[model samples]
Target: MDCDLLIIGGGVNGCGIARDAAGRGLKVLLVEQDDLAGHTSSASTKLIHGGLRYLEYYEFRLVREALIEREKLLHIAPHIIWPLRFVMPMPPTGRPGWMIRLGLFLYDHLGGRGSLPGSRGVPLNGPFGAGIKPDIARGFAYSDCWVEDSRLVVLNALDARERGADIRTRTRFTGAARDAEGWIATIAGEDGERTVRARAIVNAAGPWVDHVVGAARGAHPERPPRLVKGSHIIVPRLFDGEHAYILQNLDKRIAFAIPYERDFTLIGTTDVPWHDDPAAPAISVEETAYLCASVSRYFAKPVNPEDVVHSYSGVRPLFDDGSTSASAVTRDYVLKLGEENGPQILSVFGGKITTYRRLAEHALEKLAPFLPPMGEPWTDREPLPGGDVGDFELLLSEIRRRWPFLSERTSWRLARAYGSRVNRVLRDATSLAELGEDLGGGLHTREVDYLVTQEWARTADDILWRRSKLLLHVPPGTRERLERYLAR
Candidate 1:
């Protein structure tokens, strides 16, 4: 097979590049060794906002770009991305009240705040104060967004596929060699090894960026990515409202306690220096204790290690800028373009989900000389797959109206997950029975079929974890049942 661009790694960066390039009329081929977003992309804090913490590091350009992208993304994918108000509890000794206010002012004005609301002072003594201790009386609230992170990757891949890009998850780009004409990539899938040629190659292999670069010829870059491990824990809901809380730790690191999966609260992300395998990193007992302690400081109800129901850890492929602290490392991406004469390779290093689209746009521009003269950049205003609906609630209402038999929970799930594509899954199925077998935990045959057929889901984990986040809610036997069904 031959294409204009071949992307390695199916994370946000790779998928985003594929979507953008394909939209610009480039024949794109993307291959991932494991499931799409099987690593860092899925295990994020899942926030779309300017890195408020980065202000201390003077990352003004990075923060401003991310903030602008946040609003643009929310507009394009309203179903998957919505405004989230983050409540930050102020500590007297932390940064001083004046500094906090000044930071919020900068955050609000840094980017042109479009549809999302700006920051404001809120009294923590009221309903939001229930979980808080008496010392912290007031805090500031700022607007960001919550994204279905993994789903965002899938939707981008889906859009890329619809636009004639080949997105092959579970396929590895084992090796590649460049010639005068193009790069010949050795792709290994379940079927076996095959060769695909492309004029240019995009190495967006999140954590394994260096590993992928070795496939060609030259040694890795002088400044490689320092692997930083960030872990999150899921416990029973800590606070009541739909809002999330950003807790400040004694170490000056920030942790988020966001409402997740309806019944649970997602607390996370300890930035620890990591050197272990990037493919799979387990949360240490100490890290769990740290997260629990971080949230316990702010909430009225204390959280212990035992309270954690589920936890996840991922290694961020951050560009090593010689920052002493892992938290201090910049989240801004570094796109290094390869040889000027030979088949080009653009290696992406260090990026957050909030800036993936802009990163994609930049990636294409970097490779513009090698690529064919194609369409203009068009991903900005265009919606991702199933994001054409005006609003999430309106789409949910439409689902319920069309299928009155669907319970509120079911409709809401379908509307949020499938977005405007809900009708495609619900096609011709008038009643619950017609929707087919229940594999347990609200997942039905209709939805499973849609995922398997349309979304390139080959395993139960793809549907359960990345596609829908039903992994936490599903029963013990849910995986087995889904696996058995797939086998047939």
Candidate 2:
């Protein structure tokens, strides 16, 4: 096979670049070792916002760019990306109220925010925060956006595929060598090994970037990606509203407690350095205790380690800034194009899900010299697959009306997960029996089939975890049954 671009890693950065490049009329091929977003891309706090705390690090440029992208993304993907308010309950000991207010003010005005609301002062002692302890007196509420991170990656790849790009999942790029004309690359999939030719290669392998450059493709030794491990814990919902909370710890680090999967609250993200391989990163017991203790400080109902139902960890492939502290490392991506070789390899280091689109645009800008004359940036204005719903509420109502037999909760789930694509997923099915066999926990065989055929779901975990959060809803025995079915 031959293409203009051969991208390794199906994470957000790789898929985003593939989508942008393919839209610009470049022949693109993307290969992932596992499933798309089976790694760090899916394991995130899942917020699409300007990094509020990065202000302390003087990352004004990054903050501003991310803030602007937030609104743009929300507009393009209203079904998956929507406005989320965050409540920062002022702690008496941490940064003073004035300082918090100043940061919130800068956050509001730094970007040219149009659709999302700006920050507002919330009385620390009011009913909105009535559950808070007496020590926390004042707070600030600001706007941000939330996303199903894995879905974002899949949608990008899906859009790329729609635009004549070949997406090969569970395929590994074993090695690549630069020749006089282009790059000769070898890839391994379940069937066998194959070779491909490409003018350029993209190493957006997240935590495996350096490994890919040094070991896989034999590129020049360049800046290494700093591996920072972050973790999140899921527990029973603590609050009723859609708004999330950003709580400060004694160590000055911030933790997020956001509404997740309907009945659960997702809290986490402790930034700690790790020297181990990225593929095996897991949450430590100490990390779990630390997160629970941090949230326990302010909430009326304290969270203990036992309360955690699920925990996940990811390693951030951050660009090394020579900073000793992991939290101080920048989240901004660095795109390095090799000067020695004509077969250009663009490596992305350090990025968040919130800024993946802009990261994609920047990657193309670096590769413009090598690329054929292509169209200007167009993703910002275009909607992702199933994201074309003009009004989310109206779409939900229509789904409920069409599937009057479906419970309100089930209809909402389908709408949120499939977006406008729900129509196709449920096509020609009228009654519950027509939907096919019940796999238990509101999961039917029809939905699983849709995921497998449409969303590239190969295993039960892909459907349970990434494509949907049905793992949280299903009973243990049902999950076992699904696993057995997939194994067969």
**Residue 170 miss distance in model 2 (angstroms):** 0.8
Per-residue lDDT of model 2, residues 1-488, tens digit only: 39999999999999999999999999999999998899899899999989999999999999999998988889888888888889998876889878888998899999975787888889867655845787777788988999989999999999999999999989988888888777899999999999999988899988889878985454656877889999999999997778889999999899999989889999989998989978888999999999999999989899999999999898999999899889999899888887564768888999878889999999888888876788899999999998999999999999988888788878888888878989888887889889886787778888887777777888888988988788888876777777776666
Local accuracy of candidate 1 as per-residue lDDT tens digits, 1-488? 39999999899999999999999999999999998889999999999989999898899999999999998999889889988888888867566778889998999999975787888888998866657887899988988999999999999999999999999978988888888888888999989999999999999998899888888653235466899999999998877888999888898888999999899999989888888789879999999999988888777789999999999999999998888888888889999877667778999999999999999999999899888998888998999988999967777877888899987777888889889988899897889999888888789988999899898888998899889988887878999999999999
Where does candidate 2 have its weakest 10-residue lDDT segment? 215-224
Q: lDDT value for candidate 2?
A: 0.88
Instruction: Give the least accurate 10-residue stretch of model 1, judged by summed lDDT.
Output: 215-224
Compute the lDDT of residue 303 as modeled in candidate 2: 95
Off by over 4 Å in 2: 216-218
Clashing pairs in 2: none
lDDT of 1: 0.89
User: Each prediction's TM-score against the native?
Assistant: 0.98, 0.97
For model 1 the local lDDT of residue 15 reads 96
